[model samples]
Target: MALTLALAVNELGTNSVKYGALSNDVGTVEITWSLRPGAEGRGRELVWTWVERGGPPVSPPSRRGFGRFLIERVLAADFEGTVKLEYASAGLVCALVAPAPEDRAS
Candidate 1:
């Protein structure tokens, strides 16, 4: 789980540096985490989004890259959550939903 989150952050950070909305220090990337209630506590999903003020609107990479592919594999294998990407006018939002470890054990 640590490794998965680390990679997620790394990928988001890299994208922010590359084609992110905060390109040139004009925008900022916002990241956050929270646990959802119900759903058998499988709501411990993670949301790592890159938000900025200036960018040519972005979309998820069509062909998965090595890093992204790895992230997807980890999320599905460990959390059983779906990794999703949304393009926003402000920037891009990436979300992953997974069942918590405890829930998976049962």
Candidate 2:
């Protein structure tokens, strides 16, 4: 799930540069993630958002390239998460959220 979100963010960042506001010097890309307390203090949930500003307008890529498709598919299959697209005055944004099990790494 971590890898899924990371790659998804990475792909979106690259795509922002290629197709969104980040194409211009005035653009900015914001990538952020957080672990929030779940309902009633239960398991944590991970949320990530990527936002970019100042590039050309875009429609979703018509063809699903391997990286783009893979990121979406992985988020769905492994984490049951969804990718959301938002177009704003500044630029474009993608937000993702999923349940995350506790890390056992010592």
Q: Which candidate's lDDT is highest?
A: 2
Give one digit per residue, the lDDT tens place, for model 2 in 40-104: 66577777777776677656666778766766677656776566666665677777766655631
Q: 16-103, model 1: which lDDT tens digit per residue?
A: 7788864675767666665555365444544443344566577666777876776667755666677766667667777766655555
- Runs of candidate 1 exceeding 4 Å displacement: 40-54
Alpha-carbon deviation at 48 in model 2, angstroms = 0.7
- After superposition of all CA atoms, the RMSD between model 2 and the true structure is 3.6
Stretches off by above 4 angstroms in model 2 are 39-42, 87-90, 103-106
**What lDDT would each prediction earn against the true structure?**
0.65, 0.70
What TM-score fits each model? Answer: 0.73, 0.71
What range of 10 consecutive residues in model 2 has the weakest lDDT sum?
97-106
Cα deviation in Å at residue 100, candidate 1?
3.0
Q: What is every candidate's alpha-carbon RMSD to the true fold?
A: 3.0, 3.6
